[model samples]
Target: MKENRSREMYEEIKNITKTFQPRLGVIKDEKGNILTESKQIVDRWKRYCEKMYSSDSTADQQEKLEETREDKEINLLPLRSEIEWAIGSLKDGKSPGCDDI
Candidate 1:
């Protein structure tokens, strides 16, 4: 019967998933030592994010942006009507993008 076949297929899929082991590559720290423990991995990632997104970088980035703006002549600004048309052209009810709309 169709019900029996569906049940067999579900059981086969369950067994396959139960045996599945994702192959994760090795992660290391700044000292070039392999990190195996979950806590160590989490801590390493935390440290990396903290270093990458430190508060002092914001002011430095703003200064660099101002310098770049002063050095470059920007003439590719889109008109407000063009931007509205672009937004209106997009279909609704779709999945949100990376910035979540």
Candidate 2:
């Protein structure tokens, strides 16, 4: 269920980003490492969500935000804690229904 929600949000963000086409300005992270994972996702989202395009600052920034929104692979904006708990349960073999990993 959570995976499905994550996929849905991902698709929605992808659609929005392609529609905006932000220039991505630049993407070096705090450690001076170009967040390659984020950069890759941003690039793909831009290509995927192109409802229309314009040479305006707002559009580009919106796209950039939407594209770069995902901080980590497992993070879905709406279900972070739920997913985290599930993972913790799995790690501890405490999930009530699952017999094995």
Candidate 3:
């Protein structure tokens, strides 16, 4: 039992210490130049994300959205009977979904 445990521990340690070399395909910059250095690749990705998601609205737009929200009707929750019907409709003996239901 001790020998088996030691062998398992050795295998675990070997797996942990193994260098993980991920095969990242060639990543190119916006100018179509391939980036090789780690810093250059990271910076190119940062610039891309910034350009892609920089269109967030300003604070004034947020206030306008809040003001408009009050005009919309409030949504009601489903009745207990309706919820029970939905749950009862699911097939039996299958794995539960990510929600565990």
What do the candidate models score in CA lDDT, each in turn?
0.85, 0.64, 0.82
Q: Please, what is the TM-score per model? A: 0.45, 0.18, 0.38
lDDT per residue for candidate 3 within 1-101, as digits (tens), equals 46559888889899999998898756999889998988898898899887656656455567788989987767978899999999999899866757643
For candidate 2, write residues 1-101 as lDDT tens digits: 46559888988888888765566545654345564576665765574354235456568888888888664566537678888887776755354675664
User: Candidate 1: TM-score?
Assistant: 0.45
Candidate 1 C-alpha lDDT tens digits along 1-101: 46659888988889988865886556899999999888898899999998778888777888899999999878879999999998898889765566543
Give the local distance difference test score of model 2.
0.64
Stretches of candidate 1 above 4 Å error? 1-8, 14-23, 75-101
Cα-based lDDT at residue 97, candidate 3? 58
Error of 2 at 95 (Å): 28
Ranking by TM-score: 1, 3, 2
Worst 10 residues of 3 by lDDT: 51-60
Off by over 4 Å in 3: 1-21, 56-101
